[model samples]
Target chain A: MTAGVPVEPGTVRIAVDLLGGDGAPAVVVDGALRAFGADPDLHLLLVGPPEAADELLGVVHPADRERISVRPVQRGVAMTDDPRRLSRADTTVRAAVAAVVDRTADAVVSAGATGATVTAAVLGFGRWPDVRRPALIATMPALAGPVVLLDVGGSFEARPGTLARHAVLGAAYATVVHGVAHPRVGLLSVGTEAGKGDRARRAADPVLTLAPLPPGAHYVGLVEGYDITSGDRADVIVTDGFTGNILLKGIEGAYAMAGGPPASGGAPRAAALLGVAGTVVVCHGAARDDDLASGIALAAHLYRRGATAAISGLLADHARDGHLTGPGTAADGPGRTDHGADERTEETP
Target chain B: MTAGVPVEPGTVRIAVDLLGGDGAPAVVVDGALRAFGADPDLHLLLVGPPEAADELLGVVHPADRERISVRPVQRGVAMTDDPRRLSRADTTVRAAVAAVVDRTADAVVSAGATGATVTAAVLGFGRWPDVRRPALIATMPALAGPVVLLDVGGSFEARPGTLARHAVLGAAYATVVHGVAHPRVGLLSVGTEAGKGDRARRAADPVLTLAPLPPGAHYVGLVEGYDITSGDRADVIVTDGFTGNILLKGIEGAYAMAGGPPASGGAPRAAALLGVAGTVVVCHGAARDDDLASGIALAAHLYRRGATAAISGLLADHARDGHLTGPGTAADGPGRTDHGADERTEETP
Candidate 1:
C-alpha cells in the first residue's frame, strides 16, 4: 500500500427495516446477512425490535459482527394501515427513515408497505422543490442496458405537471445512477404514435415535450409497454403510478411463468424513492429473501453513487428556470382527487 | 349403405378482410391459404380487392376452389384513420361485417384496426341490447387454464356501469368458450382487497359485487396484475382497455424477454369483439401470417360454437331484468368524454 495514495471509500451504511416484510424479522434478517456477506465494506443499521437485531446477530461471524449495529424500536406498520400512519412516531419504517435523516445511517431500505415507506421518506427527508410528487424508480436490466421506469407506486394520479416533473427525475436517475450519457426519456402510452394513449397521457404528451430536461437528457415522444423490457426506444420511461405498478408485477409474473428470469435478472422487487432528500428504497411487502437482499444492495448502491444528492442538484437548476412545474400542475389534476393501488399487502406475485 | 342419406352441415363460412393488416394482402392471402388448407369443412368469402382474392385463388387446390368466393371491394381502413372510417362504403372491414349480416358468411375476421372492426360490427350487426360499450376479449393461456381478459382496446373510459357490463360479457364467454362451469370473475385492480384500486376501480368494485352475474358465475372482488397471466384467482379479469392494452403488450414483451412464450402460447394477437350481435375478431395491424390465420380461426370457432348467440342470450335474460347496466353508468363516467385509445389501432403487439 502506498502512503500517499488516496484510499477508496466504499463504506455504505444502510438502515434495514427488520419488521418490514411479510416474514418480517425472519426474511429481513436473512436478507441483511446475505447483503452484508456479499459486500465486505457494507454496514447495516438494523432498525426494529432488539430481538430482531439479535436474530440477525446470531448468524453473523464475530469478526463481521462489528459491521452491524442496532437501532431498536418495537412498532411495525401493518399493510392495511394508512400510509400516513408512519407519522404516529416510533413505527419501524418511520424510525428507519429517521436514521437516515439524523445521519445515523447512510440510506434506508424497507419491505414494509410502499405507501408507508414513501410517506415516511417524504416526511423525514423532505421532497425536492421541483418535483411535487416523490416517484419510486425501478431499474430493469433490459437488453440494451438498464431501463429506468418510475412512479412504480409513489402516487396514483398522473397530472400533466407531475408527468413533466417525472421526466426530469427519470432522466437524471438514468444519468447519475445508470450512467447513460444522454438519457432518452419517454412517456408510456398504448402505442408509439403521437395520439395513442388515454386522456392523462394525451394531455401530458405536449407538456413533457415542452419541459426541459437535466444534463444531456431529451424527450423521445411516446413509447409502448414493450419498450420497457426491450430498451430499444427509451432509457427512461415515465408513467403514472397505477400503470407502472401493474406493469412491474406483470413482468415479474411473466418471468416466473417462463421458469426464470433472463440472465441479467427479472423485474426488480424494490424501487428507489426519487425526489426525497435521503436515499430510500422500497421493497414489495411480500418480497422474498433475495428480493430483500437486492433491496439492501440497491439502497447501498444509491448511497455509494450519490444518486439522491446528484439528481436533486440536477432538478434544482430546472427549478431556478421556473420551467420545472408543468402547466396545469396544481395540488391535484382535475376530477381525479386521490387514487392509486390500495395501501395494503400485495399478494398476487 | 342407405338408399338415401342427409349430410350434416359442418360448413362454417368466414368473411375475411384481406386489406386489413400492415402487411395487407400478402400476409392476409397467406393466412387465408393456411386456414383453407387446415379445415376441410371451412369456406371463405374473401372481401378485399378482386386482385387480392385472385392471389389467394392462385394457390388453392383445384378441387377446393369451390369452397372459396370473392366479395371484392378494394378499400382498407388505415390504422391511423379514425374508427368511424368503417362507415365509409366499400371498406374491406365493413364489407366483411356486411357479409356476416347477410348470412353469406358465418362470421367476420379482420387484421385491421380494432376500433374500426368494433364500429363496423356494431353498425353492421348492431350492439347487443344488454351491452353499452362493446368490449374486446382475448384469451390468455395460464397455468391453471385459460383466462378471459376483456376490453383489450374496446374503449378507454372505465365507467362503473361499463365495467359491470364487461363482467357479464366476460363471464358468459368464459363459460361458453372455456367451459368453466363456475367462472370466477375478478375486477382488475392493484390489490385483492375490497378497496384496492383507483377511483374507477373503487367505484366499480361495489357495483360489480352487487350486480347479478350469469349462471354459475361469481365475483371474486379485486385481483392484481398477476391474476391475468397466472389465473390462480379468477377466470375472467376485467379492466379498462387502456390498462388492458398496456398489460397485454407488457406481458408479450416479457415473454419475448424470457426466451419465448410458455408452451401454451404467447399473448394473443387477435381478440374477439364482444357485445356485438355478429361474431367478429380483430387482429393486430402488424399481424404475421399465423396471427391472421388465428383471427380467422377465432371467428370461425365463435360462430361454430354459437358463442355470440349463447353469450348474448345469457346477457339478454339479465338485460330483461335490467341488471346489465351498472349504477351511475352513463355514456361516459361523469366529466370525461369520448377519449380512449384512438379507435384506430389495436396494433403494437
Candidate 2:
C-alpha cells in the first residue's frame, strides 16, 4: 500500500500540531488543507486528535488524499500550561517533534504556546553544540529586502555573549536561507550612537564589534529601531528576545493600522527557530488559517533548502575555529549573567 | 515696542530652539517660519545665533514681523555633547528653557538631543513633587481617537515605582489633555498575560495592579506593543524609556514603509514632557522642517490647554489622599532601585 504512494523527489513531509493556535483544530485543519492544496509534492503528518485529521481528509481532493497521514494524540499543551509539562510526551506539539526525531517528517510546525514548542523541540531534537540558548529569527518583508530579526522569543536573556552568538546565527541564517551575501549585522538600540542604549545594549555593542562574525558578515555600528523596518542599515538586526518580540508585534500593529502592509509585505506571522538540530517554524498564537499555511510553507522551504544543516555546519565551523563561546564565557565580560532561566516560561509569538 | 504688537486672548507664545535637531538652523528656520505662517495667534521667541534669527526675520511678511522676537546666543548644544553640559547658560536649548522660566514664553520646543533637552527642562522647570523621573509622552493618532505612550525618552529606568508613577501621569495626561473620558492604562510587555514578560515587567506588573490611578482611570492589566498602534486594548501604554523610545521610532518607520500613515494620522514626532512644572515638547532629533513645525504646534496646543497645570493638580489630589509614593518607596517593593542616573547621559529621540 505504501509503495503505491507517489512520492516525488521534492516531497517534504511536515509534522503539524493541530491543537496549536487560539483557533486550533478548525484553523489548523483549514490551514493543512490549504497547504496541501497549494503544493502537490507536500505531505502532512497531523499530530492531533483523529477527528481533526478526518476533517482535513473529508475536504481534500480524492486524488491528493494519499499525501496526508495522522498521528493521533488527544492531549495538547495549554497556553497557560507550564513549559516543563512537555516532557510527558503525550502533548500534540511534543508528538509533532517526535515525528521529526523519528524521521517520519522533515520538519515540525506548531503555533502552540511558544515555551512548550521550544521545550519540546529542545528535548526531542536537541540543541546545537555550544548553544546555551536558542534564538527565534523572524524575517520582516521590508521594501529594501528581507530584514532578519533574532531572539524574537526563544530566549529572553540580555547577556552580551548571548546577543553576540545570536548575531553570528542571524548573519549565517540570512546568508544561507535568504541568500543575503555579506549581510550587515547590527545591534538594535534606542539610537545609532555607540553608548545610546540600556546597560545590556551598551555592553553588547562592544562585544559584537570585537566578536568574529560569519565569513562574509560584518557588524555595523549601533542601529536604531527605524532600521528594523527601513532595512536601510542592516540586513540582520540582533536584539534581546524581550525587545525583538515587542518590536515585531508593534510593527505588525502599525501595518494593520495603515490599512495593510506595503507592496513588499507586512510583518511576518511565522518565525524560524534556530540553534536547534531540526528545522522548525512557529506561527503566531492568534494565527489565522493563512498564517498557519504560511508557517507550514516556511518549514517546507527551510527543509528543502537544507537550512538547518547548513546553519548548524556554519556554527560548528566557527566553534572549531575557537571563535564561538557559549553564554557566561569570558567574552561576555562582567555583569553578563544568564537571565534565560527566569524568562524561560514566557510565551513566544 | 512690544505693546504695539497685537496680543490676542488665544495667542500662545513658544520659545523655539533655532539650533536644535540634525538639520539645525536651516531646518529650524524653515520650521519656525512654517509655524509662524500657519498660526495667526502664535508668537515665536527664537533662541539661537543672530544670523539664524535674522534668516527667519528675512523671510517673514513685514506686517507680521512684530510677532517674532529673537534671543541671540552663539552656542548650540551638539548631539555629541554631554547632557550635563546643558548647565552652561549660553546653549540654545537652555536659553529656550530659560525663556519659559522668565515668563517670556508659555512653552518650549526643541529638537535637540533628548538628554540635553530633558536635563535643561529639569533644571529650568523643576520636577513636580513626588515625581523623581520625568516622562516623555507621545500620542499616536489611532483610529480610536488617540493612544498615549509614556517614557518615550525622559527616563530609561525600569524600576517598578517609576513605571507606577508614569502610569498615573499617563492616565491623567490622557484624560486631561486628550480628553479620554476614562483611560485604560496598561503595562507594555511581550504578551498580555500576567507573567509573560522579562524580570522588569514581571516586577512592574503587580506594582501597577495596586498602584493608585487617578480618577476615571483603571488598569487594564498587561498590554503588548501592538496596543500602542491598534488602540484596541488600552488608551495609555506605559513602559521604560528604552523600550518606549525604540517602539515609537519603530512604529514611525513602519508607517514610512507602508507608503504613508492612515487617514487618522501617524506616529507623533513631538512628545510632551510630563512630570515637569512647565509645558514642554521634545521633537525627534532627526526632525525635518515639518516635524519641527508639528512640535511647535503641539507646544502651542498644550500651553493653550494648560495641560501641565491641570495634570499637576490631579497628581496633587492623588498625593493629598496619601496614595502617591515616589521612587524607592516601600510601594516599589524590593529590588527596585534608581536606574535613571546611569542612562541620563544617553541621547533621547
Candidate 3:
C-alpha cells in the first residue's frame, strides 16, 4: 500500500473508537469524514456514543449513509484510566475490538491508551498460536525506503526473547505489507558493534543472530538509531517498546522542530499491531484530524493486504518446520505465555 | 557557557585524544586546530603519537607553539577493542584522563568509544563519593534555553535507584552549569501520566518524586520524549543510558532528514561526563571535525565554569545534610558502587 495515495479498490470495514484520542469525538468525526471522503470503498463502524457517531453521519451525503454504522458505546477509556477498565465491554475501544471479533468490521482502529487497546485486542481476538507478546509495528519513510520499527508500545519489557520474536514480526510485516524483498532486520542498540548496549540489548543480540527469520529476511547484526531514518543499515529495526515508543515520539518532535518532515514523509502517527488474529491500527493519543485519518487509512490498508493472516501463516509454517521453538514460542512453556496478561493489572491506560 | 560565543576569558587547558574517533588523527587534529583558533585562551595538550601531534604543531606559528603540548601516547583504544584495555596507561583516552589527574590539563575531551572513555574516567578520577553511577549529560538547545538529558552513555542499566540518583545529578548539573533557577526535573518515560511507563520507570517514578533534589530544583513528574526537543515540560530529563543514547541519536538523525535542525540549534554531538571528579566531555564516535571542535569547546567551557567541582560540591553539601542517603548513595552499599567497574569485562569499546 503506497503512502499519499488515498484511493484503494477493496471495501474495508473499520471499527473506529470515536472517543479515543485527547481531542476525541470531534477530531474522530472530522477524521472519519476525511477518510470516508478520500476513499470511495471505505466503511466505518463508529464505536462510541450515538451523539458522536451521528455527528459524522450527519455530515456525509445521504448515499454514503448506508456505509456507516454505530455501536453506541457510551463509555470510552480515558487517557488516565486504569488499563484494567478495558475489560469492561462498554468502553469504546473494547467495543471496537468486539466489532472485529463479531465479524461486523474487517479491522480495528483507535487513538486510545495503547495498553487499553492492546488489552482489548488480545481479549477480543486471541494471539496467534506460536506468538506470546504482540508488537506495534510502524513504517518510517526513510532515505532508502520504508523502515519497519516494532514494539512501539505493544510490550514495554526488554526481554531478549520478545525482541527476537519482534524481529520475526517486523520482517514478515515489511515483506508482506510494504512489499520489501529480503528485508534486513537489525536490533536497535546504542552502537552497531556486537556488544555496545545495555544488558537487554547485549543478551538479545546473539538470540536475534541465531533466530530463524521468515524466508527472504535476514538478521543484520546490530544497528544504531540513525538507521531508523537513514535506512542505510536495515529495513526492519526491532527494539523494546519502551525505547521504540520514546524514539518514535522523539523523531516526531524533531521533525516538528525542524519546520516539517523530509520530502518522503514524516514519522508515522499510526502503527499496525502484529501477532493478533485480526488487523489492528493504533494512532497517537494526541492525534490530529490528518493523523487520525491516516490511521484509518492504515487500518483499511492492512485489512485489504491481509497482513494479519499472511504474517501469521508464515510464522505457523516456520513453527511446523521446527524453527519457531525459540524463546518466544509456545515451547517456552506456560510461564512465558503470560506476556500481556500480567500487564493488564500492572499497567496504566 | 553560552553556545555560539567562541571566546571565553579564562585560560582552560584541554587534553585532546588524537586517536579516538572513527576518523582518528585527521579529524581530531583538524578539530583541535579549529578550537585553538576560535578561543585565544584555549591550551590543548595533544595526547597521541608524536607523529600525529607534530602534524598539528607543524602548521601553527612558532610563537603559538608554546600553548600546545604533546603527551606522546602511541597506543589508542580501537572501537572494537575490549573495554578492559582502558586500564592500560598508554592509550590515548586514558593518557588524556591522566593529564587531568596530574593537573597537566583542566579537562579531557575524546571521540573515543563511550564505554572505554567512561571506564577510563571512573578509574582515573574516581566517581563522586555519593554517586554510585556516573552519568553523561548532554544539553540540547530546545525551544526553551536548554534541556539537560542525563545517562546518555555512562550507565546502561535501568535500576530505579540509578535513575533517582541521575535525577539529582541532572538537576545539579542544570542549575550549576546552565544557571537555570528552579529547574524542573523530570523522569523520562513513555507518557506524562504518573504510571505511564515500563517496569523500571514505574518503580523509579515514586523514588524520583520523593528523592530530594538540589536546591532551586523541583521534580516535575514524568515527561515524554517530545519534551526533550520542546523543553516545555522539564529542564532536566533523566533516563537510562540505553534509551537516552538511542533517543539522542534518533533526534540527530531526524534533524538530518528534515534538511537541518531548527533555528534553536541541532542535537548535541558532545556530552559532559557527570559523577566523575574531573571535567570530561565525550564526542560521538562518528563525530565530524565541527562536532569534535564543539566537544573540545564544551570541555573548555566546563573547565572555565568549574562545573565538575561545583556540581560535585552541591551534591556533597546535599549528602552532608542526609539528603543523599538514598538508593545511589554510599549508603546503598558496595553492590551498587560497582556500576562501571563490572562493565569493563562485559562491554565493547
Write down the RMSD of all candidates, one decimal each: 5.4, 4.4, 3.0
- Chain B TM-scores, listed for every candidate in order, come to 0.91, 0.95, 0.93
State in Å the error of residue B241, model 2.
1.2
Off by over 4 Å in 3: A1-6, A326-349, B1-5, B326-349
User: Worst lDDT window (10 residues) for model 2 chain A?
Assistant: A1-10
Q: Name the runs in model 2 displaced over 4 angstroms.
A: A1-9, A83-87, A336-341, B1-9, B83-86, B336-341
lDDT at B321, model 1: 79
Q: Quick one: ranking by TM-score, best first?
A: 2, 3, 1
DockQ-sorted candidate list, best first: 2, 3, 1
Local accuracy of candidate 3 as per-residue lDDT tens digits, B1-349 = 1245346789999999999889999999999999998888899999999999999999988989999999988888888886657567778989999999999999999998877788889889998876777888888899887899988878775566788888889998988888898899998888888888776677678878888888989999999888999999999999878788899999999999999999999888888888888998889888888888899988888888888889988998988887877443432334321112233322211
Which candidate model has the greater TM-score, 2 or 3?
2
lDDT of 3 at B195: 86
Expressed as tens digits, the lDDT of each residue in A1-349 for candidate 3 is 1245346799999999999989998998998898999899999999999999888888889999999999988888887876557567779988899888889999998988888888888889988775677888888999789899987888875566778888988988998888998999999988888987765677678878888999999999989888899899999999877788889989989999999999888889888888889998888888889888899999888888888888888888877887777444532323221112233322211
Which pairs clash in model 2? Answer: none
Tens digit of lDDT per residue, candidate 2, span B6-48?
Answer: 2234889999998888999899899888888888999999999
Best model number under TM-score: 2
Among these predicted structures, which one has the highest lDDT? 2
